[model samples]
Target chain A: MTTAATTHHSAVLEHRDRFRPRQAAGKGHVSVRNVDIVFDTHHGPHTAVQGAQLEIQPGEFVCLLGPSGCGKSTLMNVVAGFVKPRHGELLVDGQPVAGPGPDRGMVFQQHSLFPWKTVKDNVAFGPLMAGVGPREAESVSRTFLSLVGLSGYADAYPSTLSGGMQQRVGIARALANYPSVLLMDEPFGALDAQTRTMMQENLLEIWSEFRNTVLFVTHDIDEAIFLSDRIVVMSASPGRIIADIRVKLERPRQAELLTSPAFMALKRECLALIREQTLHAFEQQNRKH
Target chain B: MSVKPGPFQASSAVVPSSTGERGVIQADGAATETVVGTDAVGAAVEASHARLPANWRRYLVRIAALVVAVMIWHLAAVNDLNLYLRFENVPNPVVVGTEFIAQLSSQTFYLHILHSMERIAIAYGLAVVIGIALGVMMGRSRFAEDIILPYIEILRPIPAVAWIPLAILMMPTEQASIVFITFLGALFPIVLNTVHGVEQTPKVLVRAARSLGASNAAILRHVVLPGALPSIVAGLAIGMGVAWFSLLAGEIISGQYGIGYFTWSAYTLVEYPKIIIGMLVIGGLGSLCTLLVRKGCAPLLRWQKEAGRS
Candidate 1:
């Protein structure tokens, strides 16, 4: 495919694949009941997510897991206060979902590091915006950079660093805000296999220590099985939750768990559900044809 | 299709520096090549010969070119190459050089230089302030762009000297009119370029700043301006050139003292060498201004150097 055509296809597929709302988020609490996401594309109303309902407790690492084209990201946005659901109430901290605030930190798939900013400056940006003094904000940023194993890279520009290094800066930037909950949209989806594995382990290590309530979206069932305390599986087309598996694995889940029979078995089960969703999607496409 | 004897691995790589040395001496006069191995990141040395930093070498070349030009002038003047031209008007290079030196030491030339410099200083100051303000404003919002771009484009096509009549009508004095005209010349290029630079700042850069929780003002200062720095410096250099052009034009039309005024005065008296001197002085001053601005921007844009190394 031509590059422009491919990009256009990806963008269209992105909108068809994930739900993005046009309006600001509202609130009562961060709860979604029968939420539906529909977009008016050139092909008419493209239903991204339909009837997705989930309850996330405070300090829970919940993974919204599904196959490609599933609107798992749609559900994450609903909770992050970026999307206003068509037919549901979303809440955070016992209040309805308002527009994005410092209370919820978001780490994107791409690091999106400011090329002009040094690592410390990029990390300290939120605190600086919130009127924190430079010296204090800097100290906090340094601590977070150290946590991410990028302490020496504090003065480095994102452009100078590798993709993995840049993403560490992104994580540090979000964590420096000390948000109650962290929302990640496939933060390691762009990394190579080795880097992605390293990042996943780093993320789990972070979760074990801070235990920040996380709503992560990913297509990798293995990753969901590895990182999540519970996995929320959704189906595509007009998206809906096919399964919600509670992972009752013990605390301090290490990378070693990934090789265990138990983790593999869980991954197999999740893969079965995603495969079923893919089959259903094909059948649906055939029906339309 | 090969494994061990793959084309890339088997090819003998000619190192760029040696090739470049040959290229500099050859008729092509370009940097021939620079060897780049995969992931062989190296420290940045100075600019290549082709990308050589403008230095005394360039000025010396300019001087050599000037000497050649002078010799030609002397030849043509003495030999009467232009058979159709009148004899009384043409002067030899030596006569011009002697006259130029005498003028340089005299108060008459210095007064003109002072006058031109004063006009440039004032107009350039105003141009920078207005251009930066307009540029930043135009850059920030699409609405401002829609309103400003059409007007800038329309006025840009109209030469700064074309506004002289209008300036004369509006302003009471000749000095005011000349300064106004000069300001018009400097202003358009500065604003146009500044606006272009600021608007062309990468959207990704702005988005990165936004995600970092930066205020709009902070984004403008830290991201937008720095991102646009190279272009802005380019614009400043171009603006100085335009300012110099305007200064000469203004003096030509209305000035008691200045290089342009002196050149025009010499032309009326048929003094060809003094006119040449005025042109050279203008060229020198313009080059100096550009060099100063370039030096100022170099440290702030160290990434440009890093980019070269990589």
Candidate 2:
């Protein structure tokens, strides 16, 4: 196991030097200012996110941690420019986000892959859409597929792959465009616990090499602590940010760190915050009923 | 315990060595043998041994059923069986077979078959183009759907046969009239299915495409078109069948040289054997056209079959 890890580490380093010259600094800064999102349901206008504010530095890894219906995904979608915020605005790299563009890549939970395309073609889609020539697009796809350890299955269709493999392909497809920011909405949420752990590690390794800003959304406390540099916890019932907890754990984290006392402490803090918010949400629902 | 590296080692290695070892152990336990056991080898041999005879038996049963049906038809016609329904005027299978052979040697039979095929080709091609265009417009824009969909709904349920008299009066020639009827028959299914396919395209895919920097036209081209293909292909197949149904109606009423005209003229001339032969030829041609549609679209849908396998 140690030898394999060392070999993979060296390979990642070697590829980092060759294919991914470190991204220029100050490229992927994300600022969400007083954002509010609302949906008009049959009953009335429902507020999804309320006065949310966040700032992620270039090359930072941040996770939006919350329970279901807390609007964490909605907030991420706002950043991805898929949803229009009813009130405030979002800016990426100092530019206002008018709509979804190639500058920000997104990974959904599962089944977001173009099932009609081959794994290679799915990865190549972004570059091709950017008007890159077919040959260059093909090479770019090959590079990213190898980065995700999926070079062998490039010819296979998305549906033929396991969930973990599909998510890996989704990551490759997103990164192939060389987006300034990568937004992942529960990318590993559908995988088994074991697969999810491995995916998290792989994602961190890729992020370290690319050093692109990533805004990850998840409900798992351990996952947020394990992957992100900062964990932004949100509350349900008019979803809003409640806590912006910075993780002080050291870099190049391993699976073994998951058992470390420092990790557990962060987990404890997040758990308490989430429990309080969940109870508050429950009480609000009860009062409405 | 020793761990054997699987063929998928490069990809599975991403799972971390600990889980990979667990996977090996699970595989060994499932085989209920030593780590290097011949259990998988034995299963392969047994499965191959079992499959051939089962497939052979299935084919034999199908052929037997078809042969029995033909034999019953032959017997009934020969005996002049009439119990509330008459087989007395019906031609025997042997006589029909002889007449079919005779028709196959004649140039007029070929001409009739060609006329029917040509009408279907022109009509179905027009339907595919117009239906998809209208469907995409309706699907992508609410204003287009509201304007166009009402007229489609009102016109769709009327059968192709009902259009024959009006089509003949409106068209300049018999061929044009027959083609118009066939086009009407095919148009609705293609339009309806294309609309359903476009509307059914997953919203997530559209979002994914947009985030990947695709423009509106690019999204429609890459995401919407491919996503709606299976449904469109289904519509094409249905439209082909309906085109044949309506083509025959139009051809029988007004066509100078077509399979439907040949069949009806045979009936009027009391050429019973030729009529049976004409019916068989029409059935064969229809099946052939449908088979062509499916075969032509198979390559586009190969991913669907691969996905279904797992």
Candidate 3:
């Protein structure tokens, strides 16, 4: 059974490599150039994000870290092509983002999976939509489901699965399309602490294997630090890139790294910057009131 | 884990452990089950074991209530009880019972039932198709809504009874008029509810579909349709009820063979007992049709129940 499983795994790996040849140097390059997003509200035109300039290399994991209403998510959505920036452009692999496509996979904060579909079907949806044959889509779903440790729940509906499990399926679903860039809008924000930690670990494991460019958005400083190679901190509101801090911590990180000296130092640096911005934002709000 | 010999115990063992892991992942599944397990399971076990007796008791209670009602009716009719209302001309329970039994074996009685059923089936089926199509279009596109909504809003409030004269004039035959009234009765509720369902489909799901490389047409077919289904099913059930209501109204005025016509004709001939029988048959058939709608839609909505429970 072990030998058979190993061979099957290897064959799937070979098939995947052939299907999407990984550019060893540059493939999933994301560039956000002076991107500004504004929402027309009842009051007036509100700036959600401003002058958001950043570049993510192929296979790099970057987190847009900010407080609530900081428009970190909006910036990420621009890359996902769900939101059109008022100014500047988003480019993925040298092509301008016109609209959402299979090349850029996204995981929302919660309840994004098609509830009517079984877990296997949900994971297979991208492949099916991309015009993959039914049998091949089913096989791809199986492979991704197993990758997320949800092989037993292939037939179960998304509603039947736990939140963590649903998010795992979400990840699997996103990855099944072999997207060049994975955009996550605080996917683990809804999970409990323990589950969130486990999910982070699981995501890292998957990232190590696939090496897709990931642009994750989150409010949690620790989560951003733990998950990404670099953390792009944003101002509280009318969000702009305030700081770009590289996580020098070694990869294959464990839960214990949360308390390490280097980790704490980085966290302190992030905390000070975030505190100043949050205070400034509060004072601005007070003046408006 | 300790080995359990009994099937129940073994099953319980598996459920708790597997669901415990699931709980950690989400906390809604295992936590509730484990906390309430002993009491809930015991109650369930007792209910299952004594289901036969319990069912019998329920039937007996229903029978008793109905018997009491019938006894009152019998007493009132026999006594010729009159205050503000008159029972002097009313047939007693025994007379109606006898008439019902007689009608049960009659070929004409079956024909009346078959006619009503056939009309309802045709009208309701048409309502389901046209209502859903129009509803989806209206919900998805502002242009469609702008063009179609005025007609829907104006027609929706007008009761089916009011449409009888216009329908009779509009349709060529009595059967066509009656079916048209029934179709009109069913259409509005279905179309309105379907519109609501389509509009209520989550924005995130659409975005997810888009991100997954689904085209606009694919999103509609796969995401919007399924998302709107639960509400559509609800609309269908309500529409089935309204269809029966209008069918009876139409049949009383225009149908030659339906139960409504049978009841009205009985009133004209002073066959009071048969009138009661016809009324009862109509009630029974309406309930049955609604039950069929719910049962037919249950498989499509299985996920909703599971999600609600969790």
Candidate 4:
């Protein structure tokens, strides 16, 4: 029985390998060049991000960490091609981003899994949209579902699963596309602390395997510190990159590492950086009011 | 996990039911049924609650209420208690019941029913197709909405019954005129509801699909359609109810043979009992048709059931 399970697991992995993009191709090299994003609000034109310049190396796990209402998500969306920059250029590898495409996969804060579809179908949607055959898409879904440890829930509806499970499926769906860049917009922000931590670990494990360049947007300092190779701190509202701190921690990170001195040091650094900016933003709001 | 299997241990080997709601919530990816929050009496109550299908129970209650209403009507008519209502002229339950049973044996009665069903099926089906197509077009494109919305708004306000004169004049055949009236009745609700549903589809889901490589057409087919479905279903339900009303109105006014015509004819002949029988038949058939529609659409709406269950 164990051998059968192992064989099946390996078979799925093999199938995944066959479908997986060329190793070099899968690792996204994103370059955001002095990008500015403006939104025409009911009040007036509001700058969401201003002069946001950042470059992510291939296979790097980067987090855009900032306070609420910060344009971290907006900047990430620019990379995802959901939001076009008003000025300056955003490129993936050397190609300029025109709009959202197959090369970049996104996981939203709200597990936007198509409720009409079953778990496997939702995961297979990317492949099917990319014009893969139904049979092959189904198999790709199976492999990714297994990858996210949700192999048994292939037939279940998204609404049936708990929030954490739904998010896991969301991750699996994103990964199934074999995207060069995985863009996450506060993906685990809605989950409870325990689930959030577990998801973080699960995400790292998956990232370690796939090594797709992940651009995670979040307000949580601890999460950024834990999951990212580099934490890019941005100032609140009309967000600008303030600090870039590389995580010096070892890989294969465990739950116990949260208490480790190295982890605490990084967390403290990020917390202080965020705190100063948050206070500044608060005072600015007060002045405006 | 120490379980020494003995005959005296657990009265029943506890089945690990997720309940998908309460219990010591399992923090696993799989919705594993953890054996927590066990209480024999509580479990029995919950099991009973779960076992008794809500839909069946709801229908049973409706049937009971209907029966009670009929019994009261019977009592009032039989006793000639015109205290509030004119019960003296009304047919009693016994007379109506006997007529109803007799009508069931008559081929003419079946023909009336079959005719009514066929008319409703065609009209309602046409309404659904046209309404959905128009609604989707309006919802997706601002230009379409601007161009077509004024005409829809103008026509939608005018009652389906009011359309009968124009419909009869416009259409050559009586059947076509009746069907047109019924079609008009069902169209507006379906179209409006579909529009609302389409417009309400979350932008996030569309963006997510787009990021996943779905083309604009694919997004519309998969995301917009399903997202708008609950509202569309609500519209369809309302559209169906209106269709029945319009069918009956059209039939009463101009139909050669239908359940509505049967009731109208009975009234003309002053056969009070046959009128009541016809009314009851119409009510029963209408309820049954609506129930069938809801049942047919149930599988499409399984995702919503999970929320209600939990």
- List, residue by residue over B223-285, the lDDT tens digit for candidate 1: 888766555655565676777777788789887888889889888988888888888788887
In terms of docking quality, model 1 is incorrect
- lDDT string for model 1 (A170-235, tens) is 887876766667788888897778667777877776555456678889988778888888888877
lDDT per residue as tens, model 2, A136-191: 78878877777777788889888778778889899989988778799999999988
The two-chain DockQ for each candidate, comma-separated, is: 0.11, 0.32, 0.28, 0.28
Grade the docking of candidate 4: acceptable
- A1-289: candidate 3 lDDT, tens digit per residue: 3553454356446646645555333579999999999999999999999888999999999999888898999898899999999999889999999999989999999889888889999998988987878888898888888777777789987777767788888998998888889999999998878778878877886776678899999999999999999999888567888778888889878778988999999899878877776677668768988
**lDDT for residue A163 in candidate 4, whole number 0-100:** 75
Q: If ranked by lDDT, best first, what sequence of candidates would result?
A: 3, 2, 4, 1
Give the chain A TM-score for each candidate.
0.83, 0.89, 0.91, 0.90
Off by over 4 Å in 1: A1-30, A38-46, A67-87, A277-289, B1-74, B83-93, B200-208
lDDT of 4 by residue, A25-52 (tens): 4459999999999999999999989888
Please give, for residues B1-310, the per-residue lDDT of candidate 2 as tens digits: 1111232233332221110111111110111112211122233344455578767877788889999988998999999999887999998889998888888899999999999999999999999899889988887889999999899878886888899999989999999999999998888877776787788778999999999889899889988988777777767767777888888889888888999999999999999998887787887887688668766976886676565444
Q: How close is candidate 1 to the true structure, as a TM-score?
A: 0.78
- Location of the lowest summed lDDT over 10 successive residues in candidate 1 chain B: B21-30
Model 3 spans > 4 angstroms off: A1-25, A272-289, B1-56
* DockQ, model 2, C-alpha based: 0.32
Ranking by TM-score: 2, 3, 4, 1
The TM-scores of all predictions, comma-separated, are 0.78, 0.87, 0.87, 0.85
